[model samples]
Target: IPHLLELMGFRSSAYLSHMRTLKTLEQIGAAASCRVGREDILYQFDVLREYVPVVLPLMLANVLCPSVLPEEVATAREHVLEVQQNIGENTESLLCELLHITAYRGNTL
Candidate 1:
């Protein structure tokens, strides 16, 4: 068990895998109109934003309650709706996919 733990130590394999793909793509001369190297960086940041809506419902429930002050509940509701609006920015075609991904792999995001 200790040997297995050492194999999966501090550095995560997923992050290493992502970096490996990015570097390998650049080394092999992948081309793009925009910067290809930046694509993965943007994706990493976008991922943080993309998962919010997926967990918002459960999060709000955990933090909120019918016993809480009415005003606090209202404020929390608005904040959640605002996040939903941001997720739906321009369009919400990806919302369903985000939900699916979160349901299947919430920890991964």
Candidate 2:
């Protein structure tokens, strides 16, 4: 179960890394990131209107056809674990997580 959670968290990083290396976002002067909510995952970007034509297809490709290479996965896994550890050590973060659990009742938030 923990492994699955880690994979879910890491996969977005892996995908983003793949896209960045391929110059999909940077070449078009766009910035992109992923967010995972309780019920949904979002892949979002900001780019100039003129650059949209160049970035949109690349973004779609990254989303529709992800290539989570082993190296990216390894790096993302390490990053996710480090972040999780940092959050664990932060009292405010722990309280926020507890608040979510209590307020959401383990349902989607």
Candidate 3:
């Protein structure tokens, strides 16, 4: 369990120390760090991915439809297109290393 926690980046003294320094810097206005949680970040990306299907329709509608969307909305849609293109161009895959529940059960680093 301790090993797993370290692998996941908690129970690691070095990481905790770094986080402490970062927090201090943020407090003194020297640096800014994210306050959002993992779930929040994941949810935002999930929402963005959900818009993939409508991207083409939205772009086509921009040409055919008579109504003009607000500038901010147009800019946001362009942002989505850029994000989608970025994702599509990427070719990296995450490493697969399953953590074990018992002591020293999985592959060691």
Candidate 4:
């Protein structure tokens, strides 16, 4: 999926956004596979988004197949760690809040 998106000339920002969606899909699939209740799954999904810009890829890694090529989970982990370190504590908190607000807005009509 990632490779195909890249080959089709998707920009990096677009690719990252799509990757985030893929991660969400994987989580929902995992929840379903485990026979989780629909309401519980939705709640968990909402909680998962709160950790966006930080732990998203780690959560995604739990659901992704290990044999997939290009190792996007690893890349995402590295990127997140880099951002966490470079931005330090205060900026990281602010960015997380901003990401949350943006995500909330995107989810709303």
Candidate 5:
């Protein structure tokens, strides 16, 4: 679910296709970013107060009506795989993941 939500802003409704979603946010000096927390996924945007009216709709549109293009999914998958590979190489991260696996066992953490 987090992986899917992470792509929410990769593209938006028809009017905001390709890179327009991100480009529009960039033009307004805004940024759309997300992270997976221990319990939930956080999707946030930063923009000037005056631009909330504009940014809010766009942000909502991205969340409610994402394009989720196949190319974007492929790219995201590759990126995730690369990050996992890197984590495997980092001892601290590997240990953390191992600890979670061991602690959770058959349960979701």
Candidate 6:
């Protein structure tokens, strides 16, 4: 039982890491206006956005409830928020570039 639990824990950790990487790439692509060749990246981003907040709180519940661990939660939350902010800023820049590209394309046509 203990060994099984350990294996499950490792699997969960690996899954989380993979999810985070995919999410980061999506944010970068959205921000940079660089098209992602893989559809899976976008799908993963959608899933992560839906579940990350809930999963995060559950994952840290033991450390957060009754008494808050401000430092750990704050750090994690900040990192997430920073990623979101970066994506927003990047998205705006990408939109501007896209507009310019569209205008140029229209002019050429």
Query: Which candidate tops lDDT?
Result: 5
Number of clashes in model 6?
Answer: 0
**Shift in Å, residue 28, candidate 1:** 54
Q: Which 10 consecutive residues of model 4 have the lowest summed lDDT? A: 3-12
**Residue lDDT tens for model 4, 41-93:** 21123344444644355334434422233555456556666655666568867
Count of clashes, each model:
0, 0, 0, 0, 0, 0
State the lDDT at 63 in candidate 1.
26
Model 6: which residue pairs collide?
A: none
Q: How do the residues 18-39 of candidate 6 rate in per-residue lDDT, one tens digit apiece? A: 2453365465442211122212
Residue-pair clash count for candidate 1: 0
Model 4 ranges off by over 4 Å: 1-70, 89-109
The true-versus-predicted C-alpha distance at residue 103 of model 1, in Å, is 5.3
Per residue, candidate 5 scores C-alpha lDDT tens digits across 1-109 of 4554565444656557757776888789998787765578777888889989988778677667777678877877787777777886799978977987799898875
- True lDDT of residue 91, candidate 2: 91
Clash count in backbone of candidate 4: 0
List, residue by residue over 1-109, the lDDT tens digit for candidate 3.
2222122221113223334533533444442222233123111111244444533333233224423225434554666566546654454411111222243475342
TM-score of each: 0.25, 0.68, 0.23, 0.23, 0.82, 0.21
Model 5 spans with C-alpha error above 4 angstroms: 1-10, 13-15
Tell me the tens digit of each residue's lDDT in model 1 across 1-109: 2222222221113223324433533554442121122113111111244545533432233223213344544555666566656766645545764766678683533
- For lDDT, candidate 2 versus 4, the one ahead is 2
Report model 2's TM-score to 2 decimal places. 0.68
CA lDDT, every model vs. true structure: 0.37, 0.62, 0.33, 0.43, 0.73, 0.39
Q: Which model, 3 or 5, shows the larger TM-score? A: 5
Off by over 4 Å in 1: 1-67, 89-109
| Candidate 3, lDDT over the whole model | 0.33
